[model samples]
Target chain A: MIEQFFPNVNWDTMFEATYETVYMTAISVAITAVLGILLGLLLFLTSKGNIWENRGVYAITSVLVNIFRSIPFIILIVLLIPFTRFLLDTIRGANAALPALIIGAAPFYARMVEIALREIDKGVIEAARSMGASMTTIIFKVLLAESKPALVSGITVTAIALVGYTAMAGVIGAGGLGNLAFLDGFQRSRDDVTLAATIIILLIVFVIQFIGDFFTNRLDKR
Target chain B: MITISNAKKLFKTKNGSLTAVDDVSLTIKEGEIFGVIGYSGAGKSTLIRMLNGLELPTSGTVDVNGKVISGISSGELRKARQKISMIFQHFNLLWSRTVRENISFPLEIAGVRKNTREKKVEELIKLVGLDGRGDAYPSQLSGGQKQRVGIARALANDPEVLLCDEATSALDPQTTDSILELLVDINKRLGLTIVLITHEMHVIRKICHRVAVMEEGRVVELGNVLDIFKQPKEPITKRFVQQVTEPEETKETIEHLLNDYEDGLVVKLAFVGESAEQPLITTLIRSFNINVNILQGKISHTQNGAYGTLFLHLRGDVPEVKQAVEYLEKASVGVEVITND
Candidate 1:
């Protein structure tokens, strides 16, 4: 009876699709987290009042983030199809969709990172400078360490946003849980499968929220 | 020793050019606990900031032990700063770092090895009397403990000069005393030249060997504490001294006292530096053969020595009143006569 209403609800198919979704989301999220944060830091460092303040670098990064952020995620996926095929020799599956997801999420994540870093205590920077710390030491040792709680909170925000974006990746044959839900449930009229995917996503969100809150509270001195 | 000659610092803010530290020249001798006392916005802090090149002078020279600090390159400036440590009013220790780690930061930046750094941190922890609390984060400590950690951290580089910019202003009076005693002990044991900037005259009296009183970005009175205290020249300096011990009784109070004993004369006397009040008061009555009715008195001991003030209502012949004033003046009592109208 279950198989009849939801033909794709077979345990092997469901687990495999869930595994694929986790794998794709994890890889893209990890990639975006690193590159996005570094880019965000660059934007921050090159802006006014930062250690490496540079107008030209700041203007360039500002424009790039703005341009990328303006483009709709769905449009970005379609627009990258040609480049995706060129890079990976395929535009119809998970591998092709991975780069597009990373590029799209990176800018969003970068913005979040910049906001988080900017929120660090100004007094911390003053203390670091009066200690006669080097510019590099102030950035890596003083700044990054001091902004850890904010960075963790930013990561949680980025990770949850990436999950939503990953669901949209179903458009390009990225066989995650979203693609399974859309293709086998929505398109093929399977209500039970759709309900199951929605429940699973909620569980994922709850886990992310729990871990993020714990780290934030632990690191905060105030 | 530190020598600042014609030192001037001008900052260009949104309001246009503002002279933070005007052409202020002064010398701070080695091993002396020198003080800079001024009201807020008096450039006392700016003058201290210039000494370590934290705020570079717009013109003139700041020579700390023969090296011109204001002209040094950025790298050299960093090295100079390590040699001239500073503690701030807010106790600027890194909140992310533990107390021990904060103390070890300067040593780490100076490239001291890990084991040596650990040993130095341990010594500093003990030196500041924060031995077991070394592992505590800054938030876990009270304001006084936080400043103690600041002192230990500033001493990490073994700097010859320690600049304290309102280090105790944020603390209560009792905490300020303990902190001042700690600085005195550090000065004696480490032979560290301390330049303390404060608005509190009592603070200057308690610990400063030498003091310069600044008003409106100018040093109006400068001398060893006793010289400034016993014979203050400027009105501002007089006003500062008045905060702790008034050298004269108010006219209204003297008038109120004189209503009953209208036959006597009113007089105020200041005693400073090794002038024992007991002997001086006893001698005044004995030598002049006069009755001195003490109206009000406060004896204070400054860093240099004992000093105080006494307001007296003298009942005697006019000739004897003159003798009593002259006698106290000869004893360096800084006598001032008050007549009720």
Candidate 2:
């Protein structure tokens, strides 16, 4: 009865693929959070009227972020094959997929992080400065702390996007749910396997969103 | 003590150079509540910000408690700022921080120990009258409560001088009074010198010992609060004084009273200092043969003394009214006859 409808879905392989997908998403999201925050802080601090306002640094960073963020993810993976091979000696597994996954998603998340930082009240920063808070203190305690909820929600969105990017990375020989679905499901006409993988992917996305919303709501006092 | 000598602040804008503060020089005494009153863009904000080195004067020097705020190095200035704190018009508490945490922020910046910081935060919470709301977030507090937290934060470092930049502007009148009372209490208790800037005359009249009236990047008039209230020299100063001394409808009420009574002479009498406490109205009725009808009156108390204005209708013989006016003049009361044009 369980295997009645076009029985080609292997539970063990499906579980393995799900684990691979989760592993890729988790690692990339962690690294992306750090890199994105640094880039975002740079963009924000060097912009006009901020503490470290510098036109030259801001313009250079802005151009770099824009160039990376504007490229399509699939094209980016193809374009970064040489860099990925040089960095990791191989370009075919979950680890190989990480460089492209982080590079593709971090700038996207960096823009979100910048928007979150901008939402903080300028007066809060001034009040900190009036207390003689050093720049490091302002950045960590005031700017980042005040914008925590926005930053969490921004990273949540970025995390979900990275999950999707991981699947896209799986298309180019990076093993994950996408690789299993394409090679063993679509190629072999096993509709049930593809349906199973889709279900698992949707479940993963829903769980990430639920966790993100919980933390965001808990952090937001305003 | 603070001394601002030949201080000037200039800004380069799209339209060219704008002088935010011109050659403004003032000496504020220790442990005194000094106030700077001005309308928007009158440079009072720039002037006060200069005292704490928040805004650097393009030309001159601001010396606060023996440290030259304008010429100090950034490292020294940061150290100076811990002793010379400022609070803003908007109660700028960090929304994410609780009242205790917000108040604890300055102490943290000053590198206070964790145990000392916690104890100081509790004491400050009590000082600002926020005893039990320490654990509540700023979002949960009212405007008045937020300001209490702001004041607590400013006081956390035991600042020698507290600069209030339109601190009560955003509060309602009742809240403004409560906050002003708190500031006065802090000033008296801690012997902290306060430099506050506001556009409201009521704030100055209530707490300020000395007041400076600013207009167009300069101090138009400066003197004791009571003296300024008694004889406002500039038109701007007079307008500010009138804010508390005269109600908005006084002119229309006088006109209406003039139309209703065609026989009496309506006169405005100003009482200042010790004279306001005397029973001059009772004396006038007993000594003269006239019917006195009180029209409108207001008395404002300053740090130095009480100042008031009273409008009266004297319906009697013209000679008796003339005698009454002379009598008021002899009693050191300011008298002006209100006549129909």
Candidate 3:
């Protein structure tokens, strides 16, 4: 019954496509989370009278984040295509789309990360400083640790957002569930394929969300 | 010793430049609990921060352990900060780190090894009487417990000087007492030079050996606790004393009190040091044989010792009362004639 579709069900092709989707989302989320959190921390600390207080630095970073965040994902893909191609060699494939995914998600992730970091108790930072902690020590030990729960939650936001961006990336030549649905289900009149793709994407979202919530709950004791 | 000489801190505000600390010069001796008493924003905090270079002096210098802290660079300033541990009014323990981790933070910064840090942290926990709360997070602790962790953290590096900026202001009265008691105990045991900033005179009275009263970014009165409490020169200091003890019979109170003048004299006698506890009233009665009626009295202890004041109305012969007052004066008790009532 399952093999009735295209002679042998194209199991290898489906598996490869799903693997590409997972690889893209995993790599993009990891890179974006780390870089975004770092940028967000620099933004927060620079503004918050830690080590270096540069109003110019803060203004620049703040404007940059907002600008990146405001641009639509599709336009960003097209606009960044030249740069992405320069960086990754092929703008119309899976490997190349990862860079765009990172670019699209970093600013969004950073916004959430900044908000999360800023929400930590000010007293906690003051405590660390008073205890003779250097700027670096305070960042890694106090700021990041205290902001961990929110960071986890921020990562969750970034992941979900990245998933949406990943699906959108399918509009370009990046292969993912959305491309499968669009190319094989919507563009072709295959209702069963569309239903299957929709169900699988939903499952992935639920799994990611559940893992996010669980870690967030565990780390969040405030 | 902590020497702050002509130290100034000016903050640039929207309205204008405001001085938080104004060329403050003071010294906190070794093994003494010195209190910098002030209302909020009175520059006590700024002064304390200047001690370890957390807040740099706009002009002047703070020499701790003979090192000019204000002239040093940021790295050296941080290293200097290790020798002078500061506790906050807010009990600023890191929320993410366990109480043990928070306590060991300074030690960790100073490059103590892990096993050594763990043992030291345990010892500090025991010292602060938080023996079982080593693994608890700041959120899991109460306000008092949090401050205890703060105290432990402050003591992590075994600093020569411990600066407390309104350390008891956020605590309940009972908890404040215990914290004060713990400070006193730490002072005695470690001989740690404690520079405590507080608005509460009672807190100073509890543990401070000497105190400086700050107001509007200036130290108005500076002396030992007993001297400051007994003969507070500044109006702000007097107001603070009045909170704990009744305000002594002022000229106004005396005028109101002296409305009905009697035959005898009303004399205000003050006691300090040995005179404070002496049986002066009994001696007065025995020598002058004057009928004494107590009108008003106030007693307080300072760093030097117990010092106080007593206002009395002598109801016998005027000349006898006068003679009794003179005798009281001769015995080293300060006597002020409030009125001849």
Tens digits of per-residue lDDT, candidate 3, B70-129, equal 898878878878989989998877777789888888998999999999999999999999
Clashing pairs in model 2? none
DockQ-wise, the better of 1 and 2 is 2
Q: Sort every candidate by lDDT, greatest first.
A: 2, 1, 3
Ten contiguous residues minimizing lDDT sum, candidate 2 chain B: B123-132
Ranking under TM-score, best-scoring first? 2, 3, 1
Over all chains combined, what TM-score does candidate 3 have?
0.92
Cα lDDT tens digits, model 3, A33-140, are 888988898788778455567899989998998898889998998888889889978877677788778988898888877788788777777767776788889888
Q: What TM-score would chain B receive for each of the candidates shown?
A: 0.94, 0.97, 0.90
- Candidate 2 C-alpha lDDT tens digits along A69-164: 999999999999999999999999999999999999889988988889998888888888888999999999998999899999999999899889
Ranking by DockQ: 2, 3, 1
lDDT by residue for model 2 (B91-119), tens: 88999988988998999899999999998
What ranges in model 2 sit over 4 Å off? B259-264
Against the true structure, candidate 1 reaches a TM-score of: 0.90
Model 1, B1-341: lDDT tens digits are 89998887777888998886777889999999999999998889889888877677889899997779888788887887788888989987777789989898889888899999999999999998887898899999999999999999899989989999999999999989999999999999999999999999989999999999997767888998878877889999988888777634454677788787778688878777666444877777778867888888888877788887778988888898888788777875688888766
- Tens digits of per-residue lDDT, candidate 1, A1-222, equal 766765657667777777777777788888998888898889988989777899999999989988888899889888888889899998766666788888888888888788877887665666666667788887788777777788888888878877777778875687777887899878988878887777777788788889999999999875
TM-score-wise, the better of 1 and 3 is 3
Question: Which regions of candidate 1 fall more than 4 Å away from where they truly are?
Answer: A1-7, A43-50, A53-60, A70-72, A78-90, B247-265, B338-341
The stretch of ten residues in a row with the least summed lDDT in candidate 3 chain B is B243-252
Model 3 regions lying over 4 Å from their true place: A1-15, B247-269, B284-299, B309-324, B336-341
Clashing residue pair totals per candidate (backbone < 3 A): 0, 0, 4
